[model samples]
Every structure is written in C-alpha cells, then in structure tokens.
Target: MTPIGFVHSTRTDATDDAWDAEATTIHLDGDTFSPEALQGLDAFSHAVIVYWFDRVPPEKITTGARHPRGNESWPKVGIFAQRGKNRPNRIGVTTVRIVDVQNLSVTVEGLDAIDRTPVLDIKPYMLEFAPRGTVSQPQWSKELMSDYWRTIQSQ
Candidate 1:
C-alpha cells in the first residue's frame, strides 16, 4: 500500500533514545494536509502514531534475536513477540502527547520513531478503546510490563 504520509523526528536511530526523554519536537510530512485530518485530535491528551522502522538493519532479522528485552535470563522469544526492530513490517506504534499543531506539523511529546519514519496512521487516544481490559497479552508481557510507564517513555 502507498504511504499516506510520514513522521519527522530529531533522533535518527534507536541508539538515540534520548529524544523521548528530552521532549524533542516531532513534525509530520504532510505540510498541506487538510485541517479536517486533525478533527477532534486535540480533545485527548495523547495520540498513537503507527510508523515503519525504515532504517533497521535487515541482518538483525536474518541473524535471529539476541534475547528478549536484552535479557539472556529470559527464554529466547521470537522477534515478533518482543518489540524487536527486525519486525516483519518494521512498523512501530507509539503514544505521544499532542503538544501543538500548525499547518500540517504536529508537535508531539514522545514518539520513538527515528527521523523520517514512515507514518502509517494516526489515531486519537480514548481510554474506553484502550488496552485496559484486553487480556490477549502473553505471560511474559504481563510479567515484564513496566510499572512506571508515564515516568519513562519508550517503544
């Protein structure tokens, strides 16, 4: 499918994880997109950005994994189960705050995508539609989920 738009962030690689911690500005590529595209977007405090991990090294996927969450103590989980950069589609979804919007640039809080990431879609945040009641997560996901989410943001 054709990409409808793209995301622009300061950090260009996964190694530069500081962008989330420092609140770097993120811009959208659709400079001429209609304002209607952002309808009701400001009502929520946050949004979910779906994007492609374009720069991930292909060898990472071919070479297999290096342990889940970089923890060798944990069993070897497939790349798909964890947030491995070598995902089949190399797509990433991040929830970030809508700091401001001007023209087509959306200034957001904590999107973990690298610079020039291909944005697949943008969805508004709604607690009712969130994962609060979802139980489909794996046992390891449930156990290793962060207790301090809002404090430290990442993919």
Candidate 2:
C-alpha cells in the first residue's frame, strides 16, 4: 500500500516509552491529498493514526511468548498480548489529540512514531468505535504502561 503521508517530529530515535508530550506534524502528499481532503477533520478532537514501523528490522519480529520490555517481573505472553513494536506486521496505530488541521498537514499530540515514519492512514476517533464491554488486563501490563505517557524526570 502507498503511504499517504509522513510524520515530522522532534523524535528521531526509538524510545521504550514516554511519547505523550511529543508534538508531531503529519505532512500529507500534496500531490495525492489536497487541502480539501482535510476538510471537517478539524471538528474531531482526536484521530487514529496508522503508521508503518519502518525502523523495526525483520530480525526483531517475534511470534513466541516473551516478557514485556524484557522485564522478568512481567509474565511471558504471546506477541499479541503486548503492544510491543516487534511484531509480525510492523504496523503501529495510535490515537492522538488533534492540535490543528491545516491544508495537507495535521498537527497532533501524543503520537508515538518518530521522524519520517510512513503514515498509512488517518481516521477520526469516535466513541462508537471504542470497546463496548469491560476492558481487562493483567496487573503487570498496567505497571508496564504506568510511565508510558508520563514526563521523564531529570536527574
């Protein structure tokens, strides 16, 4: 599939967590997506961004059970159990707050992707799309994501 756009952000390297503060700009291909394409997007407060994890090498793809973040405290689970970047398909989807939408560019907050990441698609976040039943997860998963969006403290 063709990438409709690319992500422009200050982050260039992959980090284990803490992407909620990163401001990002998704620059759509002017040739493919015109300003009109972004019409009505401003009405939405959040968007679902589907991007390719191009930086993740094929060798890193894991299908077997493994500890999340390699932390022994976390129980070994299948690849699908965790939101790790190393997967069979290097695709990442994130729900980010839309800061602004102008022309062919969209400014977002809390995107986890790095600079030059290929954006596959963008969809508006709607309440109807959310899970209907109770959401459940293990305690270890909660601990693993406790600091994912928190600001890192300086030494």
Candidate 3:
C-alpha cells in the first residue's frame, strides 16, 4: 500500500523509548490527500496513526520466539506476544493526542515513529473501539513499557 503521508519529527534514531515527549507533524501529500480529508478530525482529542517501520531491515523480521527487546530478563515469547518492531509486517500503530490540524498537515503528540517514517493511515479515536473486557498482561510486558511513554522525569 502507498503511504498517504510522512512524519516530521526531531527524532531520527530509535535508541530512545520515551515517545510521549515527541511532537510530530504528519505531512500529508496534498496531491493525493487533499486538505479536505482532515475535515472534523480536530473534533477528536486523539487519533490512531498507522505507519511503516521503514528503518527495520528485512533480516530483523522474526516469526519465532525470542526475548523481548533481546533482554534475557524477560521470558522468551512468541513474536505475537511482544510489541517489538521486528515483526513479520513492519507496521507500527500508536494512539496520539491531536495537537493541531492544519492544511495538509496534522500535528500530533506521542507518535513513536521517527522522522520521515511513512504514514499509512489515520483513524479517529473512539471510545467504542476500546477493549470491552478487563485488559491483562504479564509483569514483563509492564516492565517493558514502563519507560516507553515519556514521564515527567524524561521530559
């Protein structure tokens, strides 16, 4: 699928995990997606951005079990069990707060993608789409994401 837009952010490297501090601009191709496409988007407080992990090499794709982030402290688990970037399909999705919606561009916060990352699509955040039942995950998963979103200390 073709990317409808690309991200513009200060982050170029993937070493940092605190994404919440990142303020990104999704520059849509006006030739493809007109400014009218963003109508009513500003009404939403947040959105779900679907983007490509273009930086991830094909050799990094994993279908088998492995430690999350290669950290032995976390138990070895199937690729589906972890949110690692090295997936069969290098697709990344993140819910971000909408900072602004301008012509041919959307400014967002907390998008984990780096600068120049191809953005596939944007979906408005709907409460109905949230998990209906109690959400549960392993302690390791919690530890893995503890520092993912930027905390006051990280900023």
Residue 153, candidate 3: how far off, in angstroms? 4.8
Cα lDDT tens digits for candidate 3, 1-155:
99999999988897647887777999998888888999999999999999999999999899999998889998999988887788899898999999999999999999989999999999999999999999999999989888889744655
lDDT winner, 1 or 3 = 3
> For model 2, what is the alpha-carbon lDDT of residue 18?
75
Q: What is the C-alpha RMSD of each candidate to the true structure, in Å?
A: 4.1, 1.4, 1.3
Could you tell me how far off, in angstroms, the CA of residue 98 lies in candidate 2 after the best superposition?
Answer: 0.4
The TM-scores of all predictions, comma-separated, are 0.73, 0.95, 0.96
CA lDDT, candidate 3, residue 55: 90
Ranking by TM-score: 3, 2, 1
lDDT of 2 by residue, 1-155 (tens): 89999999988998867787677999999989789988999999999999999989999999899999999988999999998889899889999999999999999998999999999999999999999999998999999988787655521
Worst 10 residues of 1 by lDDT: 146-155
Residue 84 lDDT in model 3? 79
Query: CA lDDT of 62 in candidate 3?
Result: 96
Per-candidate total of colliding backbone pairs: 0, 0, 0
Candidate 3 lDDT at 69 equals 84
Displacement of the residue 136 alpha carbon in candidate 1, Å: 9.5
Q: Residue 1 lDDT in model 2?
A: 85
Candidate 2 runs further than 4 Å off: 152-155
